[model samples]
Target chain A: MTSTETHHAAGAASSTDAPAIATWLTTADHKQVGRLFIGTGLVGLLGGLVLAVLVAFERIDAEGFQLLDSGSATQVLSAARLLLTFGAVAPLVMGLAVAIVPLQLGSRSIAFPRVAASGFWMWLTGLVLSVAAIIGNGGPSGGESEMVDLYLAASVVMVLGLALAALSIAVTGLTSRAPGMGLLRAPFFSWSSFVGSIALLMSLPVFIGTSVYLYVDHRYARAAFGGNFGVNNWVGWAISQPFTYVLAIPVLGFVLDAIPVLGRTRLAQRPAANVAVGLVSVAILASLTHRAVTLPWEGDGFFSGLGTKIADLLPFGLVNVIPLLGLLGVLGLTMLTLKSAKPMLAAPLPFAVLGLLMILLGAASHLLYTVEDAALGGTIFEAGSYVAVTFGTVLLAFGGLTYWGPKLWGRRIPDKAALPLALLGFVAAALGSLPYMIAGFADQPAGVVDGFAYSGPQELWNVVTTGAFALMLLVSLAFIGLAVRSFTAGEAAGDDPWDGTTLEWATSSPPPADNFSDLIVVGSEYPLADIKNSGKVG
Target chain B: MLTLPPAPQPAPKRQVFVGTALVSAAATMLVGGMLAIWSQFRADAPFRESPRRGPIKDWMPKDIVVPEVAANMMLIAFFVVCVMAQWAVWSAKRNDRQHAGMALGMTLLMGLATLNAQLFIWSQMGVDVRGGAFNSMFYAITGVMTFLVIAGLVYTAVATFRYLGRGNSDVPTLSAHALYWYFLTAAFSAVWFVVYVQK
Candidate 1:
């Protein structure tokens, strides 16, 4: 028998029994759930991009009522934050974990498949409700208290669903591995998901409790989270700084694992890399330090006097700086791993490199926010920084999709399409964020529309940011077009696409219903590599 | 014909047992995190200046009575129910079916009794939910716990019924259910210690 036939003959089993639509909707299969998450997240991402474009359009004119009213602008800003963070990134990562963790660990299915399905539905429900509520003018700054309450309730439910999904992934990672697959031997993506899941599990619940109380106060008492506190605090904990880093943690895994496979080498300092991922959990707690920071800068002179402002970062530096340190650790180790490896010519490389750069850009911006003289908080710079990190996740998610797409859809996303898209994504991310950072240094504020006194440089910056956002929207469209096309009609990908080191590569592209026909005993992190060298299917 | 090993099954027996225990521990962490945030908010809440801070009003009747005897009774009964649940699991594992059934049945009865007592406590509360931040927290935490308890009781009841009907039970499944029950017990104990007894 051919190697492909031998591999398929060994472990393939038919676990799916229902009709197509029914199967997808009711699937306990990790792959389908992952697809569901990715599809849903893509839609959510598109929605967020559309909202961002609208906001960008308004910002282009730098003066009165360019594209939206004050209330509309505020609503769009808040909605984009909600959709991108809760509706897009979390789902994207969770979906990948649900689909990939079991396969990576050499398990047939996730530990709690039904629970994972339940979590998806719950998340979908929450996302739909929240998006609707926000669109209907029903959040913190929305005039009506009832709408705000709906917003609060919807957000809580959405976050809860994400928490449930993370819980399932974590438990699966912890419990469902093959007989000999120790924690250290699990794929980087699985390990990162495990750590990120714990972080989400611990953090989201606090947000839920706070939201519950917000509900209570709004509904009856009117005693807590007054003024913009309700909205700002939520943004602070859920979308900003350390929280975003923790959310971005899985992408680090995606890059780590993808790089090793693409580079044809084992991870350098694997244990240290795992610890770097682990450090993010502690870094999540450090997110609280941001609440104490406020920016009071008035002009470009802030940069000229950087040393004095940086010194102001000392008091909050211990906690506020941890996430940056973690990112640096990841970057340092990734470089070390790549140094010894024979890197392949592949699409994931550009995506990974750009992803790390964007993460660093965001981290640098976060550091600036902590510096008292930098006075960058509540400005376009901070928002730009957040976009950078968020965009980093998008790139990583795209990289993961590109890396795993063949295995998932039985087709490679034509490199002709993917390579250009990755490059465009990087340029767009840079254009989208860097100019805004300059504008923030120019003393341009964030989260406001139709109010700032128009200045020459500020207007120029706004125009640049607007143009970049327009390009980003186009890139997003092109990506969606390529992804959909490839998913349906692209060239067929074989079992091992990237000479991947992990277990998932051992099975066929779009693995069979039961994942594998026979169990593959995992002896090391690079199990598939071992099999390849041994010239055996099993 | 080569038969591939059966498609990866759900977590193995021991893993299921340990996994559920881990979930319970995580659940505790969640509850603990919530409490920590709530306490911080409680401390910072602008209580004195609020119009809602005054005596109980006529329009909004009090739903929760503070420090009621029924509240204490409910806590004690919950403890008893938790103990009975463990007894049922232990008896079943020891192959003592009769005692297991009896203990499980008693556990369910007491669980319902505890729920009813909590409802009683809710009715007797001298403060409205809107009375203050403390009042809001007290109700929110307890109210959520009550709903959780009902859900856990239903789950345990189903597991118990299956055991009685089949004349056999999967120890892991039973243990998982029991583990969740214990989580509920521990969570409620925390609420009792902080919200009811200490406050």
Candidate 2:
């Protein structure tokens, strides 16, 4: 009848049974939140992907190029924009990265779980309210003002939550070790997640704070940083700085996974990862200056002047491009070596390859625009480049789920049917974004608020985009159906599915409460590989 | 092949009692103190017939009205909600049906009291520029938080009703949930200081 014993008694249910609602309330277990994060993040991904398809179709046929085109067809496009901007802060990034990164790094609980949970709840609140605000207030306030508040709040909650999650991860990494875990012995995915979590901790908060400032102006009828007050310029800096690689970290994880399997040994240069990780982290922080800002510098004379001079210098921009180039190097290595693997014609492999490909496309496309913007800026071209970010994230999210859902859940997805269905989703999304690139480059009208639709080649571009949409929708339907089936009644899976090369695979298919009965610290990068090739993994 | 180690034996009852007390004290100190300041400032805004001279007005600018009071009260209620929630978690973990039921009831009652106090204050207020946004924000934030608190209470009540009879309270998931309740309570208190008291 002791309190400690009280909470612990209700957990003896079957893994297949639904968790008790109270259990969800009284629990502070990281694993529960982590699983919920994964589930909810995937749900968000599903909703977002479907939204993307609607957007894609609209891009192709803005002027009614749908199978069921009517004036109402525009609702699909409008809905997509609403979803996209529903929260200006990235949901997939905040949701998945914060949720998954912590669990992947072996932690008891987030350092600030209350803050973390509050962050998430408030974010939900923000998005829901913003969407409601948009619905209630039309035209002038619609998407721009009323809807923007919810996202602004979401950004704050996410920033707060993520900072807490990252702190938790770092605390766990720093202090929560069982008997023998060391920095060097940490799991590679966790190591990468550690690095990614740091990037999140530092960068996301600034973005949230920046967005809040912009929001306050809109809310109170002050132009503190929007309108002529410098919202546009400031946003250019803020979004580009944190997000470009708020994105890169996950891709970095996938890249880590891809590299070893192709080489089948330790990374050719393992120390370089630490160095590269640090460099990218700095680069993201430094890029903030590039955001058009309006600051009245205090403290008169030489010292202050030198600071301002340094801010304006190209070295700052150069600092950013350096890590980006290093990341490109990582991706390049993957592309060359991936050909070495037997291309396991399975669910994740194609998606992984395509994901890596879109990342490369996005990197190159964006790099081109940054270096010179006549061909891109605000055009469908820029949209296509941005698509690379979402495309890569979505691909990996779904692909990773498919490749390892069985291992994680102890349940097998319908591989033969589900694999192709998932791949089609990826292909459809990729092809869907392509027309945006063409439209931008061709100088067809772009920018959401701009009503200046191009007169020439518009119809043709619209047609191509609509065609892409048709394919994407079919793919989305297929994926959702498969996800639902897998969760509900997919075949029971076993340990070692996909011959997964990580500590995660070494445990039971769904894993036990403590993760491992006895913690097995790795001495090297390819510990799982050593186990697979020999006998003792982890 | 990978059997987990036996679950750690539940901590001693004394330890649980001490932890609950400590958490409650922290909530009161951290959360209750905030309510007093927020209420003082919220009342002060309307009390000012003309811009008076004070440290806040001098540096804060005359037109700037602070909702320090609204945030203070809301944050206090939030932590009160948290203490009840933790009490519920302690009950649920021990398989004590009566305790769990009592804890949930306490949690809901605290929420209702908070709403009553908030609406009572709102009803007494007159329309003005500086206090309007502050009051609106206060209500919005508290209203949302109240909904969450109620949701948590109901969810735990359901478990108390169903599984308490079954006599199993060892929920692996319960710890995370309790942590979040405490987390939300803590966050609201922290934000009260930042967004309200300081202003």
Candidate 3:
């Protein structure tokens, strides 16, 4: 038995003590379930990357390589989006939340363990059915009507699974904290997860409603969305300027949680950080404005009337700039925290810094996009800026896995391989997105298969984007390889490897079935730090 | 040997109540979104004539026919079910098992009636679901609510059976179930006003 098992042998009566395939499949242990979520999400990432590469290859040539017909291209785009947004990034954050929140809260297990496990399975089923429908040339955009039904059904099921998981996580946060770990004192990630879960709970059902309408429209009543709604509109907000930032809110939480720990100091303005996270949740309302960015309805129609009404009722500038406010709030808090202490050059720092920088770039671009100006509305720049921001979450998720690897798996992902790959990831992301933003400004239209015959700069930009996409694929594969190797063969990481400030570091690496050997009632944000320095915990 | 602290068990009752509340909160957002679409389709303009009031032939392809009176009847039935559900909760809280059981049974009956009313409305509609956005939305909103009503009915049935059979039930679960019934009542009323009365 391992040292952790030997130490906790008295309390090791559960099935988690037996590390077998059956244990993994059937275990309701939050840690095991979390690992399953992360692993499944990785599979999704690989699939999304392959699809992205195909799309990029098509974009490489102006005549748009006839590798897939336009309908098939639409299918690929939809599938890639579902895989990345739901399959990869959302699950990754959820996995981290599931694994880390309870431990940070000093709770032994997640609330509603069976519900969470069921959610994971449901999510997998939904993802498989949706992807299968796409592969079979039966998606919402596909020619076959039945495929469209499959797409709608599968997507709704997938969202329901996520909603279930979010409910479990949110409930655990509300009622399962350790004796004295109040809301303010709860670790940043756990608190952030709670907020993000609430946001997901609130937003996903609206999408489900939309999907239900689509299903009804496609199946029985052919009247709604005016034949315009499909997979494209389902993710339109997700790929667009403002609402896409809603997806990045949790990454900001990761940064908030990591900054104080990486700096080996207390956060500068903890309440303000919490408020900023709250502001990000509030920013979800502004997402409705994304429709205005693309639609040219200044004079007539319901959209114009509603837009004018909304502008009059609310602070137009403030509502439009909610994401900017949230991101800047994070940046300001980060700078304040770094100012108070000497930050060590560590594994998470590069990922944290680069991720935030890319996110900022995306937010800045959004600020410009939300402007009344229509010049850059339909350009390749729209896609470019989106790629930068959405991928920022990808970078942050990688860093989170690294930052919490020891606590999660009893080993650290070797910095020798990880750090360099982290840098390469940032480089590829910048190269991939910056050119598109520039090309977009040059009047290069988006959603085009072939290069426009009239535009010179669009071709040059597409070539650069294609090359950058290839490089991104290479870096991603290498990073995944390094992570797998670390899981199997990396050196052991003892408890508190980086001298973390949170409660999670107080336990053994790959903490035993029981999270802590002893209960430590936390009175401050940095509970472990206090215990190590003063020899007493609150 | 390092003796770890035993893990604390979560309060399952509290978890159930919280989970129900959260789901109800999410349901509110869905209603809001559906209303947003309804408003957009109505267009609210001087040039756009009332499609419902126009010649029946003009409503052939895209416009859907809504059964206004039947929808209003469903709303009233749902509201009555909600009242019975609240009575069940109140009786349960007071440890009045006999009253709670009767109230819950009534809730189940009313919920079934509401579902029946919905189906009757669908059967009575002049156009099928393929009629267009208005028809599609009419089905979508009512269809989703019908499912919720079925769910509430199952919960009420279980709560009623548990209370009647064992002289007790999980009060928290029952209460939470009632809360969802209340939500369904409010939601149906709002949808009724927008889709039927206002139009």
Highest DockQ scorer = 3
Q: What does the TM-score come to for chain B in model 1?
A: 0.75
For candidate 3, give the lDDT of residue A132: 83
DockQ scores of all models, one per candidate: 0.41, 0.05, 0.64
Residue A504, candidate 3: C-alpha displacement in angstroms: 1.8
TM-scores for candidates 1 onward, in order: 0.89, 0.62, 0.89
Docking class of 1: acceptable
Give the per-residue lDDT of model 2 (tens digit) for A404-478: 566446686666876676567566657656767777777764434223366567657656655655665566556
User: Candidate 2 at B140: error in angstroms?
Assistant: 18
Per-residue CA lDDT of model 1 for A68-169, tens digit only, reads 778767778888877788778888878878888888888877877777888888889988987787767777577666777788888778887887778778
Rank candidates, lDDT, best first: 1, 3, 2
Better of 1 and 3 by lDDT: 1
Alpha carbon lDDT at A288, candidate 1:
43
- lDDT of candidate 2 at residue A470, scale 0 to 100: 64
lDDT of 3 by residue, A1-538 (tens): 1124423443235563566987776767788788888888888877876776677667667574578776577678667767777888778888888888888888777888878888888888888888887877766477777877887788888888878888888998898887788999988788888988888888777777777877778777665553423556643564455665666666677788888788877788888888887777765666553263332335455665886756543554555566577778888898888898688777677788788888788878766655545467766677777778767777888888888877888888887778887798898789888987887777766765555544566667777777776777787788778888887788888777787888888777888876776667777777777777786532
- Please give, for residues B74-185, the per-residue lDDT of candidate 3 as tens digits: 8888888888988988888898987887888889888888888777777776556665666777778777877767877877887777666544347777788889898888
Model 1, span B1-199: residue lDDT tens: 5555654433266655655666666667556755765656545544333256673222222444364577778888888887888888898899888998898888889989889988877777755767766666666777667767887788778878867755444556667778888888888888777666645
Supply the global lDDT for candidate 2: 0.51
